[model samples]
Target: MLRYYGVDLLDHHRGTLSARRVWVLLKHLPRDSAFARELHGEESAWGLGEHLLASVIDHLAIGNWLFTSAHTAEGESPPDPPVPVPRPGVADEEDETPAASAGEQDLAWFFADL
Candidate 1:
């Protein structure tokens, strides 16, 4: 059976690459390879600098797509996974009613002009 994955670019300002190229690069990530060097080498080609490239790698690492290490050159292991960020509009488990779903609160405003 074949498997497929998807990558959505939320931040359009970062970089650009053909879909094929992106796929090819991500294909190497599973092996726990040294991706930082490859990214740094192709930084110019990808139209991103060290900081931006690191950000991309960090995002992938945080998303669990790839493992990364700051001291990989010295044979250190991949760092711990980054903390997951909460998405906007996602209510915490404890919050019974989020701001958007504030029941009956907006009804007063709705009938104010009526």
Candidate 2:
């Protein structure tokens, strides 16, 4: 499951970012507290909605296992929304373009390599 399905990663990063995006997020995380924070961010956000996915991840506990103070006591507002566009991945899966013809596969063009 860890290899095939990264649920924790998915939970915190489903819409706002892909696995590659997450590496960027991980880069921005406090280096000292990255591991525990990133893991905590992922685990704590289980079952959260897709829209809120990024925020929950932004609150990662860090590698040092420290908690993020949502309210900094300085009256800071909640973080802003993520960019609307999605990153690249598996585009062909969603592609409505027609597949090659049956004969195409059987033709010299298809078998050229084989």
Q: For each candidate, give its TM-score against the true structure.
A: 0.24, 0.19
Q: Give every collision pair in model 1.
A: none
Off by over 4 Å in 2: 1-8, 12-16, 34-114
TM-score of candidate 2 relative to the true fold: 0.19
- Evaluate model 2: give its lDDT: 0.40
For model 2, how does the per-residue alpha-carbon lDDT over 1-114 read when each residue is reduced to its tens digit?
A: 123334356543457545555544544544234342243433322333643654445444231123234544557654444333232221344676443334323333523433
> Could you give candidate 1's per-residue lDDT for residues 43-77 as a string of tens digits?
21332354566677668766563434543556656
Q: Which of the numbered candidates is closest to the native, going by highest TM-score?
A: 1
For model 2 the local lDDT of residue 11 reads 49
Winning model by lDDT: 1
Kindly give the stretch of ten consecutive residues in candidate 1 with the minimal lDDT sum.
36-45
Error of 1 at 88 (Å): 2.5
lDDT of each: 0.43, 0.40
Backbone clash total, candidate 2: 7
